[model samples]
Target: MNTISSALWPWLALAGLGAFHGLNPAMGWLFVAALGLHRRSRGLVLMALVPIALGHALAVGAVLLAVIVFGTVVDATFLGRGAGIILIVWAMTHLLTGHRTPLRIGMQTGLAGLALWSFMMASAHGAGFMLIPALLSLCVTPGTGVELAASPSVPISFAALAVHTGAMMAVIGGVSLIVYDQGLAFLRRGWINLDILWSLALAGGGIFLLAG
Candidate 1:
């Protein structure tokens, strides 16, 4: 109880970070939502958010694990340089190849597929970069050092990530469902243009991350 309670603030902070990232247009939930709207299926739209969220959680979790395993050895300088190079390469690939066709929302790819996609995209975009700082802030806080050192930070991080991703999907899915309900034809009419926008946004984000 007291031990469990002591871990609450860090977890909450992590969750908040997840939510913040989820809200970013570059995270790809908007693209998923748009697909849902194009299909004119509210259920599918709502369902799509699940795998997307799971994918994001997996991506962030992997980063956290990597950081823990390589603690101190992997500082911001290494992460920044490595992540920058990766992002630059990815962006160049996108620029050369152009955007692929948007994925159709369905049960075939399902949750697993969605999670995989989300993880890949988030990892490519350095989603975990944001999460690391949040965790470090908690751990380095003046009075909480001992508590943080004793607590299972990884599990707490994952739990917060799950909640944050869940909330984001809910918001994006709900908005998509509403758009579909009100103007399915309008959404369908604009789907291709929207795809272009998604590609450009992703490419730009990648470039910015690399340069920053």
Candidate 2:
């Protein structure tokens, strides 16, 4: 039991990180809130969250899957460095083009389009890469790069993904409700462009991975 509990810590941390990501406006909650307000229907916001969460899951799952499969074969240091480079490059591109040449999708865009947008946005932000360290620690032996590829645990991976997705969806739902009912009036007054902050965060995570 103690052993199992210890191993679960990284998954808990992933959920915490998912909650943090959910708090970010760039993560799709703000857009959901806006959609709800525009349509004057809270149902729209509720419906929107499904695709949003799916997109996010896809983004995170891609990186997590890669790390799980390849991190076993490659040296930990090498794998970490490669992920770091990908993240840093992603951040740089986001900073350069995200706001300047933002992708515009109409509010009337269907759920599929919304999902596509969310997927692109989350991928660009390197949201999956942000979870790599935790994933590595959970899926691989610490300091020893020994791969657990032979003993792939479906339950553990499913649990981690489910927890992370649940956390993100919960926050997005809660925040969207508040914003839909109360308005983001306060945010306009103290508006912070969170895109830059998110970019910096991606860069920071990349640096940490590289340093480790």
Candidate 3:
């Protein structure tokens, strides 16, 4: 079972990172909670999670698709370093302007609009870019041409995506529910700037990828 355990570790890491993303207030739970309050229905917050999760999935999937399609053509080290640099840049951008950014999702935004907004937010946060190292490990093969074309890692990549998305949904949904029922006043008692923490995490993840 050691072999199986080793293989499953990366997939577990993906899920863990997703959970980490979900815990951040800037991700979606805060918005969902606010939307529920605006709509005067806690159920709306739960419903909002579906589209939010889908949007996040799409943003991450886009990067995964690129890795899968070009893993053979591009060197893994180059791809990993490129993504790492992008992520570090994104993290710095967040640190500098995340709070000052005037972009805000209006309560009037419909489900589809919310989905699109979530996609953009996730992309800007380098959520998918953070997965580059895992993608390289999973999809990049030591073969050329046909051998590389029939990569065994394709299925593993999809499985990792599903696991990550599922974990994110669970965290977002649970947090939204609690925030909705308990009210935001309690959460604001000792306001912590989670954005800075998240930005640092992004930078750290990028560094880890580059180190690997």
Which tens-of-lDDT digit does each residue in 99-174 have in candidate 2? 3316677789989988888888777677888777666666666677554562663445666778888999999899
lDDT tens digits, residue span 38-103, model 3: 888988998999889889989988888777676656666666767788778889998887734235
lDDT by candidate, in order shown: 0.57, 0.79, 0.77
Whole-model lDDT, candidate 3? 0.77
How displaced is residue 10 in candidate 3, in Å? 1.1
Residues 26-54, model 1: lDDT tens digits: 56556666666656666777777777777
RMSD of each: 7.4, 2.9, 3.0
Clashes (candidate 1): 0
For model 1, state the Cα shift of residue 140 in Å.
3.3
Q: By TM-score, is 2 or 3 better?
A: 3
**Candidate 2 error regions (>4 Å):** 1-9, 92-103, 148-150, 153-155, 189-191
Q: Could you tell which candidate, 1 or 2, scores higher by TM-score?
A: 2
> Higher TM-score: candidate 1 or 3?
3
Report the Cα lDDT for candidate 2. 0.79
